[model samples]
Target: RVKIYEAMEAVILGADELDMVINTGNACAGKWDAVRKEISDLVTATPDTVHKIIIETCYLRDEDIIKASIAAMEAGAEFIKTSSGFAPAGAVVGDVGMIKQATKGKIGLKAAGGIKTLSNVLSFVEAGATRIGTSSGTSIMKEVR
Candidate 1:
């Protein structure tokens, strides 16, 4: 973890084009407050890296989902992402709605986690996801085209 933070710091310091930070670990799943605080401190210390927090929705309840979303935004996260894709469940429309409601237009929402089909991607977009993360980006764009 320390190594990862150091590496992130290095990236932030070295890359002039670095514009965002995505936290892709499920280890920070239920500990929303702590995760938010840590990310806030990290970004504050850097002040240039934009933060995105990914909450593993598979292991979180609806309340936790809401809390995490709000906490991330309050902590200065630029985006609230759903799922790290390491657990049983992935991104779902309902969870996206919760995040949207929690953030209330303060931050962008990213829907990832097993999103392969165009219909799934559309569902997330319709539900207020501003970004899509997937290995099937090509296929999805083809469908859109």
Candidate 2:
């Protein structure tokens, strides 16, 4: 985690003009109040970093998911991601919608996890996901073309 922050700081400072910082960590699962607070502090400490809280939605209850979304947004997160793909449920359209609804357009939404095909990517995009994280980016685009 410290290493990630160090890298982020380096990238932010190395660039002549830094655009945004997307914090890709599962800070939204189970009891995340403490995690949320820590992430919030990180963002506050690094005012240049635009934190994007990645909530692994698989392990969280619906209420917890909502709470985490709210917490991330309140903590100054610029985006809320659906999953990290290391959990049971993974990313789904419904989960994307839930995060979208929870954030109320205040933050961007990223849908990730098992997105391997063009259709899958389109599904997420159609479902209001502003960003698509996938290892199959090349294949998906090739398939689309």
Candidate 3:
């Protein structure tokens, strides 16, 4: 499948980390096994690379977000990411807390998408984000300075 190929390609290109988005439709439909299998496959395809499973929190309910995070962790991913940065909304603080609870410190947490300010980054970190992904790191730094 394309997901597997992308994982393989990332590894081939010397990518140390791979961020793969999960199928939100499956998760929303309660097809947890399928979601788990997809992530598991990608993890298998790139054993040497760190895998971050993006759950796209904007489309999911609180419970769904927790379930997705758990599935990703059980599937052998190293991190559970909040968004792909293409959704209408991304990386909410409440969602970050839910993911942290679901993961139980078993995996890393990344909060991404629309994180543009130092306050945003700090709030996410306070809410248990292990990593912060943003396109405005420089601007955030400028705010700090």
Report lDDT (Cα) of residue 22, candidate 2: 26
Which residues of candidate 3, in runs, are more than 4 Å off? none
RMSD of each: 3.6, 4.3, 0.8
Q: lDDT tens string, model 1, 3-110? A: 346647676567422223334353345555566766676556555555567777777778877877777788776877786666677899989987897778789898
lDDT string for model 2 (38-100, tens) is: 567666656655566767777666777777778888877777777766656567887887777
Ten contiguous residues with the weakest lDDT in model 2: 15-24
lDDT of residue 31 for candidate 2: 52
The numbered model that scores best in TM-score is 3
Order the numbered candidates by TM-score, best leading.
Answer: 3, 1, 2
Query: How does residue 72 of candidate 2 score in lDDT?
Result: 80
Greater-TM-score candidate between 1 and 2? 1
Q: Best to worst by lDDT, what's the order?
A: 3, 1, 2
Clashing pairs in model 3? none
Of models 1 and 2, which has the larger lDDT? 1
